[model samples]
Each structure stands twice: as C-alpha cells, then as structure tokens.
Target: MFETSLSGLLTGRVALVTGAAGALGESICRALARAGAEVVGVDLVEGGACDFVADVATAEGNRLMVAEALRRHGRLDVLVLNAGVQFVAPIPEFPEEQWDRLMGVMVKGPFLAMKAAWAELTGRPASRVLITSSVSGMVAEPFKAAYVSAKHAVNGLTKVAALEGAPHGLTVNAVAPGWMSTPMVERQLPEQMALRGLTREQVLELLLDRQPVKRLIGTDEVAALFAFLASDLSSAVTGVCLPADLGTLAS
Candidate 1:
C-alpha cells in the first residue's frame, strides 16, 4: 500500500472519475480519495466502491453523472474523463462497431462529461479536469487505429477545455500512459501475440524494448501523474498531454 502524501493537495474537493471500475480508474480514484477529495467513481458496469453508475457516452448517462456528483458531494471540483476502450484490429479489417465504441467512450464521453459538468467545474474553486490518454495519441501502434484516433481527439478536447477553463480558474490536462501492467493489456496480449506468431514473453519483450527503461509502466505510476494534475501544485499546468510512457514516445 502506498502511503498518502497528498495531505492538502485537494483538501476539500470533490471528484468524479468515469470508468472508475477499471484497474487504472480505481488507482486514480484511490489517489484522489487519499488526497482528501470526495470521489464518485462512475462506470458502465458499476460495482466496487463507485458512488454512481453512468455510461458517460450517452446524454442520459452524462446527465445522471452530473446529478449524482451534485447529490453526493454538493459540488464538483475534479473531473477525470478516463473512460475508454481498446480495439485491436488492422485498419482494413477494423470493425465499424469497434470504431464507434472507441469513439463514444474515448472522445464523446469526455466531451459529454465536461459539458454536463461545465457549470459546476467553472463555478468551483481550484477545479481541475484530467483525462487519461495513451502513448498511441503521440505515436503509432499496431492494430489499434480506433484507439489511436480517439486518444488523439482526447488531447484536442483537453486543449480546448483548458483554454475555456483558464478564465474560470479551472485547469485541464491529460496523462498519457505507456504499456502498463493492467487487465486491459493482459487481455489483448495473448491475442496480439497470436496475431504476430510470437509467444507472450516475446510480445512483452517487444513492448519493453521500445522503452528506454525496458520495463512496463505501472498503473500506480500513471495514477501518480493524475494525482499531480489534480492537485493545486499544478495550477499553472493545462492544455498539455504529458506522456508517462517510460520514454516510448521518444523512440
């Protein structure tokens, strides 16, 4: 267990994290909760310690999320638009359904969540919005066209929201993770390895080789970056997509 160092980082803030049931999402929730922020975790599947259930991609879901946030904490101070999906398929054979799913969760989800929470975020003090993007947004990856495109859109949304939030004292930014050890990657690893006719170990080796550190980035590491962005310490940082890719983006 990581001891909390976020004593007063977000002392009395309230946070809403979409896709909060996932490994990465849960980590971010834990980080914010430890920082003294009241966190409401939202996921389509729900469960866990999540305070609410909202789809985020649909108008109704978005509205429910905002309503739940207000009902739970009275005011929304942090918005973590982190709901997304990864579809592994080549461009030519990519499923249109997968593309729509990815876009809905990655791009549209954030837009809706931000839109629904706009008044609350802007009306609060020291409000922050953080999006969980990916290295794919900054670099190319094999068999993930939809995920890449959606991530790229996430950065665009981040920039636009940052600019809009600037005058209102709200900061918006993104943390782009590399190959992290999470269920999402593990599920795709076997299939991706089979596609390349390589063993699972070899596939991991291929991923690690791209990183100068030669290791997989941890979910907690990505969570730490989110923690930083959500804190007042990063008050001057916004409209930027910081890659936590273990140097993968450089190569």
Candidate 2:
C-alpha cells in the first residue's frame, strides 16, 4: 500500500496502470492506491499478475490487459497509458527495425489499450484516460525521430479520445514531462555518453541547461497530476496537453 495526501480524491475508484513495473508506473499505481483507489498494475514483467503479463506491442497483449482489469476489478475508472521506450539514433543511421519497434510500443500499444478498454471506460459514470507523452512530441530534438513521432501521435490520440470520451462522461488528457529522473532516462546514459563522448553528469547538465526551471521532474509530481485528472477535480478539463517539463517548453 502507498500513502498519499489523504485527499480521498479517488476513493472507491479502480485504476489500471500499464508499464507498472517502471519507476513512473509504480509511482502512479502507488499514488492511485494511496488516493483510495484499488489499482491493478499491468506490465510485461513479473510481479504484476501473470494474466496481465503481455507485450503492449502485440494485439493479444492489449486484449489481455483489459481482460485482466475486468477480472481484478469489475469496472475500470482510470486507464493510465505509460508504457514507452526511447531509442537514440541519427536519422541517417536509424535502423528501420528500431523505428518500427519504438512506434509499435509508444503509439500502437497505447491505442490498442484504449480500444480494448473502451467499453469499460465508457461504461463508468466517470472515466478518464491519462497518457504519458513527452516534451519531445511538442518540440523537435536531434536524433530522436522515432521517439518524437510516437509522442506526437500520443498527443493526437489524447485529443481524439477526449472528443470520443466526452459523450461517455470520460475525459482524456496527456502529461508531457521533460526530464524526469527515471530509469527510462538512465537507460540511455551510456549510449548518450558514447554517442557524444560526454560524461553522465555532463549529459544531465546539458539537459538541465535547456530547462527554464533547471531541475528534473519528479515521478510523484507527475503522479499528482494524474491523480488530479483522474479525480473529480479536473472534470471540465479535457483534450489538454499539460507540460510537466520544468518550463522547458515555455522557454
């Protein structure tokens, strides 16, 4: 169990979070649980129910994730779409396989999950779909074509889902975080250094320099946004792309 602000913001609700094994996923799950919602954590890894263990990149996997949510909780109140990957390669050198792989997970994966959960999400009196996009989607960066493309698609999906979900008493929104200190970012450290031949600290410093706030985002902070949107507080707010990017985009 996770402890939160005791807002009781999501009391009696049930939430399903994909990519739950990851740092952001775990934080979101725990936060939802703490907010008084029973959470079903889904991932491609173990620890999450075996029934929920399916690749987000596959059709079968997306179906199973929704099925598991129904099995664990009769109704789904919130769907947190957070599963994604990052690959850094120059456009000229970018592997076709890598581009396809990233797009499949970051774009197609979330779309399938939303499609599978449509009935359940729409069935609920109040439902929400919160997708984790990135600043890369909003702004262009070097050597991140695949990642940027997928994120842009996610934003587009969020807008469409918002329009579709509104009639069903559901809201769809996205959070675009800049540089959160998560394992996702860490995973690219060595490759980043090798590519640029810069130290880890230097890489981080360069990233921070671009941020107007000059700080990395926190997982809990991102979770807090999800909690607010998933709850009644943001009922009227939908189809919005919120930047949790430490003012990076503002600059």
Off by over 4 Å in 2: 1-6, 47-51
- Scored against the true structure, residue 131 in model 1 reaches a CA lDDT of 95
TM-score versus the correct structure, for each prediction: 0.96, 0.94
Q: All models: lDDT?
A: 0.87, 0.86
Candidate 2 per-residue C-alpha lDDT over 37-88 given as tens digits, one digit per residue, 9 for 90 to 100:
9888878886532225679888888898788877877888999888878899
Error of 1 at 192 (Å): 0.8
Candidate with maximal lDDT: 1
| Clashing pairs counted in every model | 0, 0
Best by TM-score: 1
RMSD of each: 1.3, 2.1
Error of 1 at 123 (Å): 1.4
lDDT of 1 at 85: 82
